[model samples]
Target: MSRLLHAELTKFRTVRGLVLGTVATAALIVGLGLFVAANSVSVCSKGTVDVECPTPPAGPGGESVRDKFYFVHKPLPGDGTITVRVTSMTGIITYPPPNHDTIVPGLVPWAKAGIIAKRGTTEGSGYVALMTTAEHGVRLQHDFVHDVAGLPGAVSTGAPRWLRLTRVGGTLTGEESADGVTWTRVGTATLTGPVEIGLFVTSPSDLTVHNGVGGGTAQARLSTTTATFDNLGLTGAVPGGGWLRDDVGADPEPDGPVHHPGSAEESAGVWTVSGNGDIAPLAGEGPGTQMTLLGLVIGLIVVIVVAVQFITAELRLGLVGVTALTAPGRARILLAKAAVLGAAMFAAGTAAAAFVVPVAERVLHANGSRRPFLPVPDVVTLSLTVGLLTAGVALLALGLGALVRRSLPAAGLAVAVVVLPYLAAVVGGLPAGASQWLLRVTPAAAFAVQQTEPAYAHVIANYVPMAGYFPLPAWGGLAVLAGYATLTLVLAGVRLRRADL
Candidate 1:
């Protein structure tokens, strides 16, 4: 067994394709590492905040502070009044609403509106303020619930119970509780410098007018209720953890001039950036970014090409018969060859991935926007998954090659196995029953391993409509692909054992 393993390894190294594949893999991994390291911002100095820390580069918004940290400010529930005041180093009160008619007076122009209002019949309103000598812009937003359905005939039950302010380097989270002792985390905002923050409120639901009328209908009147805020407090920035900050200036204003429409920067925050800007283009169209359907097409082509090379080159040269005679056991020779082919296919597939992924990313970045790319785990897992699937599919091709002892029919069958189900899925769509289960057995199922989005799960689930169809969980999708691979290899093994190759 050791000798066979050593021989197998030797064969792999001697193969020119295998050697090139290994080099390609190493180059990709190193290139990605360097790219990330060059682009990442270093936050921690001496394991703590450096009071004399040098200013970071201008962020997307051309702001000096490029990140933000947040801490929570808890306000009590129910109808109440609260006033928060912020005083700057220059004696300017930067923390309040812009004016009395507005929510508060003298608050930072860009600061987000942070308030924790209760649901039910009451109404709430508040304002926050910040002061900075540095030309910094603030953004205020109401943190609302996501993805929850409201009751029938009721307006959206979603309420902003938390507030988050974000800047380049820091963040703050505020939660309101009935008793301030125990507070729920409502939301958090990031900040970059020393700024005064305050919470202030006015008005309850009682004063709200429905459509500017006293005798408005009940449905219209429901919009009149508002909650007043009270008991505003401020806490110092917490250590280490902070809000994810982006280049505020780089972000396009909703009504502002258009820059790079649908650029890569727009997609930056969607994933976590790694060491630097080395990104993978999993979402775009390229050889690497081609849809799963395309991958299936490519995989089929690979199997046919390998099968043709194996059958014609070795059989026409009479090597198969000689090897079978020397081994006496046809099964052992076939198994040895299968093992060699599997290793070669795996190395080739991995090499192809390494070669294609980085180039694809660069192309996408160039065509789109410039932003940091998120890191995916090393190619080890991706390589293994693809290798296993390819090996299984290859074995079936090898078996067909042996059974037909001809290149043309085997290639045609291999292509059909990969192409037919995809064609069926496209034309008929995955039917709502056992037919969908049949779809999973196709090569497309294996490609689901490459998906990086949760939404793709829904797409895949809908693609295959079965009675018990829930889109396979990430791991489940991989397993389904593996199961198909295993079945193909098993059938190939059975054929190899019986056939007189």
Candidate 2:
């Protein structure tokens, strides 16, 4: 096996074209990425030109802070408790332009509807809530920006769900229940707010991208969400007070110009608030949230093309037979090739990512936005993720090359299998579900491993490719790609062993 590995490495090293292609892929990863950043500086330079752009620091995943929600509250300078029964919550899903059609399943997984006690109506105000989410069941969230998952249970329309938030001086405890009788403590936070208490419902305005022959923009289809609250019990704050309403994060005179449109209504013993925007730390799309990955997309294309040709070239040139003759076992030859190519791509990917990501961040900061709010570890993790993703893509391409058994056609098919799906997700302007579906099922899903943005349930943004929102978590998405590569490689090996050489 060692001799076979050595012989295969030698064969690869002797191929000047393959070696150069690998180098070029790496170079393009860094070079094209930097170029895209430079271009973004020029275009998004007309970016968020606001003095308040830098404050409220970026989210943990490098997203701009936003706090947009409808509020119905009267000031509580001291301790208080707010409870409400969320009777039902529902909304609609819409597609992008040309034909804007409303669809069902209006609720995305993390949409929130329930009761909140906030410092004030302004965004970034400290707050806490016991709410029924669209899919996460129940949760306790505070700071108007953070989430705390509740006990394992389901909460939905026609489901009897109740939430309670009690403030004891600075300590706040959130509790939830199914029957409004037995309370289960979800989580707690410490806050001293001139608390505003009321019912709130907000959606992330989930985006479905559409890509055509020309450039594409993401269309955010917002569900006109409605959440019913009954048995409204509030202590320490006067009841029947007029609710001073405003879109907390949507500044009419924004830090820049972001739409902050929301309304609250009280009727028939239930208080309902419908919010179209989000309730997050920041108001609108700032420089930190805006990202351009055209170069990386191109780099993905180049990398996969080269990786496919790496193996298909051997088969095309009849050199695979020579390898079989020398290695004694076809599996050993294939394994060695995979290892060699994987290493090469990994090294190149790491170098390119480390340099390009920092450059992109710095360029954006220099162009008028603040730097990405990523810790050193997160940045390093992102770089490593990209490096590992390149390795994964290389392996995927190699497997496809082996399956097709021809250089050009294999490379083309490789692009269709991995790169095309990825391209569609990024710019295809397809429904959010469709785009995410492609990423989840295709080897290209591995690219999601590089996402540094976190999708906060309350924060409203495009939540699409432009904002770096992928459906699956980073490692989980990589596993999907790895699974594809593994399945295909196993099949290819079986074919190599049985087929006529």
Candidate No. with top lDDT = 2
Measured against the true structure, the TM-scores of the candidates, in listed sequence, are 0.45, 0.69
Q: What tens-digit string does per-residue lDDT give for candidate 2 at 139-192?
A: 777655677788755555557698888888888899988888898899998777
lDDT of each: 0.36, 0.70
Over 128-208, each residue of candidate 1 has an lDDT whose tens digit, in order, gives 222111112121222111111111111111321322232233444333332334434334433333433323211111111
The whole-model C-alpha lDDT of candidate 2 against the native structure comes to 0.70
Off by over 4 Å in 2: 42-63, 68-125, 130-140, 145-164, 174-188, 192-278, 281-293, 316-318, 321-326, 429-433, 456-461, 499-501
Model 2 earns a TM-score of 0.69
Q: For all the candidates, what are their Cα RMSDs to the real structure? A: 17.1, 6.7
Best by TM-score: 2
